[model samples]
Target: MFVSVGVRFEANVEALNMVETAGNYSKHRRVPYIIEEKNVLKIIYVPAVSGESLAHAFQELLAEEAISEKQKVCRKCLRGEFLKSMDEENAAEKFDGGKLPSDAEKLEEGIVKNCTVEDIGGFLYAGKPPVKRTSAFQVSYALPIKKIAIYSTVEPQLHARHAVMTEAGKKTGGEREGAAEQMIYYVETGTAIYGFTFNLDLRAIGLSAITGKPIIPEDELRARRRAAVKSLARMLSSTQFGAKLSRFLPLGGIVSLAVSVTEKPFTLTSPIYEGFEDMTLKRLEKIAKEFNEQYQYYVLGRNGLETPEHVMTQLIQYLKERNTL
Candidate 1:
């Protein structure tokens, strides 16, 4: 089973994913978006969130869900530092003194069995042969929809910090002398309708990428798969997967969502383009008939469609009926 989700959301005054702090100003991540106007091509810089940020949030939720279900999660991943088994020595740390097999296949198996997050999220072990496992899931950088890309804005928000000064410091005239009483800073906040895509390959969960085989038991695989799916559903529904949330939580929920579930790997039309929902439905229909495969699609924010949670539930049910879960 394969699942693809495309989301379009509105975010106002959000400093969710920042690049760096230069002096007292924090910059929001920005990317160049290209568009055509009057038979001419133009490029504009827009505030965006990197795929790394979204992946990190998803893994954190996956770790929490796996732990909640009593599934194995490496110590590092449990603490949200996903440095998964960098080498033989590092792999041993995850096992608490237990040495990992030297063979690449065995090493991959051991890591997959030990950490659900690593199994699903993948890792690269720079050992003798440098084993690598591709992540079962993929995420696209959250960007403003193309039609609204020109209107997207990143503006600086001013903030300050005040310090209590001693009587001597006050007498010397605060910062000019020796003591600074107040500090002003700016954080770049963004406002736009952002779109991103997420794809999950259910067949890859609990499977050894090195040997192309199932590395864990059937029941355990099912459990890990459940955790992986649930993590995504929870992340989207709560809209809690970004940085600087305490101070600059985006003032928006999901404005639109489109999901496609299929027997074979398939990705929906990216939501960054307008009319992506209609395009996705039409493509799904064409592919299903041409390939003679089964698929299901769900949408929200059009014609009073289903909610994200409901769509996920339907996907879970689809997997169960096929015995993929």
Candidate 2:
């Protein structure tokens, strides 16, 4: 069975900008938008998120959660706790007179042969001139649910120490700088929504180079998809999202699925709103209904009017009903 899944989530944040561009204020200062001419008479600048950012976020989440069940797997690299490998590489380089072995040499000498984790799979196979895997997932750029507030603030930064230098036989130092101020622009309040779609085709993604397998089993794909979707929901509260400036707390999210017996894939480009959470079900149903008229698909969403768990439950139920649990 093939499935086309679309997901969207709401995030409540003090400041969150999915897309940032350099501003005229300073090279370091960045804002979420840029001015563009709508026509010969008018120009507009609006807050918008790029699809690239959402794609990257989802990719990171998926990579983090999707564990390759291969013989050679590095657990440390999978968790992003790869300090030991880095230290080992550095030590090896130091031992090799500050020059690491080339790719040919490393392959011939079998150095770090066991580092074939999913995270570094590309690098491991780089020697063969890698082939890219077209991602089955696609996400749209996020936009404000309604209105967005863009403002700037000036904050003071203090230097802890002054630069000191010893030239010749005398000690010299630059004048001590007390503090500096920086102008920062932020999105005060707005819930951004993005449209995302996943096209799951085992033939396109299931090939195993290690075993020379042509397809991945359906059970394994279901498990991976479940983990990935759960991780996607949890990614909003991730501490590494935007650090201090943006605190994107998880509000809620909805994911609807369209399972087909055939291989035809459909894309979901519908818009989602934050405050109008009830409409999520209605919208998904409408889309599913429209798509079902042309092709066979099973549609499911939350049958309630609540927040937080509504979307999560909808996803879980959808998966369960489809026997993908």
Candidate 3:
């Protein structure tokens, strides 16, 4: 049996969690195992035992701390440039000569306003002129599976779940169903972390250098990973911000209607100021709202309204029919 699949990096986190659980896995033999940064694979020439053993092996793999730790950093390293930038500023001589970060690093100048938690939002992203996304913001979204396709033994629809199962079986084959099984489980919750890096000094220098201020050094590096993490959990699995965004940001265009908006900037526009907040996540509560509306409007037409699900169904079918979606 050869089951092949490609999962998002975030999904891999849960895989580790699942494999760590002893009862989630069962290893019957020494099957070949291959684990890649973004891919996992397994092939067995045995009977039903192969399937069961693979499942357990995956669980054990998920339980490992190294796997989880790597997953945590995946979000931070999406842009190798950004990570390098942060590291550079961390060692710059500008630290002793520059000023210290007041609240943030990228948006160090962003005054710690008197605004309440209700007033906090992620950074805004405005595209270059002519596009007119005045209120559009940015979000560093690691879309784990942007285009998932499988060309192997089973149906395409079965690839996702079977991928993890196949990887697990190779780790544990004949082990009894107890601690061994718990080790076979992986994080199957489909949750990914969404948050912006709080960079102040480095961003300032990259776009508009903020000269070293007196006693307050500017070269020192700091990040708002903690703040972003705190804000991220407020959403439902990092995709649904629920109703919390309505207060800080209105729901109208794409910018206002997002469900889980991040502060990842897409570009610098005319109205954009060369400052820190330029890339900081200003409002993240409303994500993809505008995209959904536009999709529905274009697909279903303004004369009639269709539920997102219905519109999406039609869109998928059309894509499959034309092989474009």
Candidate 4:
């Protein structure tokens, strides 16, 4: 249940005892942010009464804040003072917790890992991929496009903007659709990297297919999911996928990698959306289904994921697949 404490910014949950967690933006940190403008800031503060109406409220506030030309101290200076005030005040008073909880303790869902091998030629010899963080962990991956797309509203990761409420945000962030899609890293030897972007409009996205509701409270969700899915996909494909199916390449071409949530309520619920359900199950199921199918082909499609379970099952199948392989 969502505790009505206040609006949460970059917090997420982790997993243990082999439970299935979904929908949290575990990888938003690694998402590259290109600073389009120097010292950029966002409009996030909203009144508690607005509740679910926060997005609209935020929109109005952002416009006013952007135009207000009153000579005021820069945001950085204000943040510094805020920190100083917190120091003078008891830690417990500044934050309910004496100190913020470490990210590991907060992330209650998803597997985090990195590529064991990525900088093949630079880091290692040809074909020898570098060892990265963990599979479930979010890492930087990219895809290059000759052009870009449009979004009615965009939450750009540029200049450190990490999310958006719509698919256009995905396009602006240059993220793929689906958590199963891997984040393709396009090494632009020709041009400056990070300039390439993906613009997705979540408003145009069809979350209804998974959730019964048509509204998504966390607008930046789709883009975060897109980046995370692909990152995990790559980790799964090269690592877990390799370990699991060494002996049988796409066994019977019917290999299916899926998640059997040993957890509660959402293990069965779909991503059809609940504005309240932060972890949507249907979305997880769909991601897993796609991952399983793609494993058969042994390709990640530049940067793509076949399913959320692709990495989930891949992690498990690796142990089983290796024994027989």
Please provide, for model 4 over 102-122, each residue's C-alpha lDDT reduced to its tens digit, 9 standing for 90 to 100: 332111110011010110000
lDDT of 3 by residue, 1-325 (tens): 0001111121211111111223433221222222233475543221011222322222222122212322222222222111211322321222335333332333322211111110112122121111110111122222222122111011111111222234456566633433343432322222222111211111221121223332122221111212222222222123222111322221221111112111232221111122212221232112235433111111122224243233334433432343221
Give the per-residue lDDT digits (tens) of candidate 2, residues 232-265.
4455335233222433343544433332322345
Model 1, residue pairs in steric clash: none
Lowest-lDDT window of 10 residues in candidate 2?
A: 173-182
Which number leads on lDDT? 1
Better of 3 and 4 by TM-score: 3
Off by over 4 Å in 4: 1-219, 240-256, 260-325
Per-model TM values vs. the true structure: 0.94, 0.49, 0.17, 0.16
Compared with the true structure, all predictions reach lDDT values of 0.88, 0.39, 0.22, 0.22
lDDT of 1 by residue, 294-323 (tens): 888888854455577777777778777878
Q: Which ten residues in a row have the lowest lDDT in candidate 1?
A: 172-181
RMSD of 1: 1.9
After the best TM-score superposition of candidate 4, give how far the Cα of residue 19 lies from its true spot, in angstroms.
24
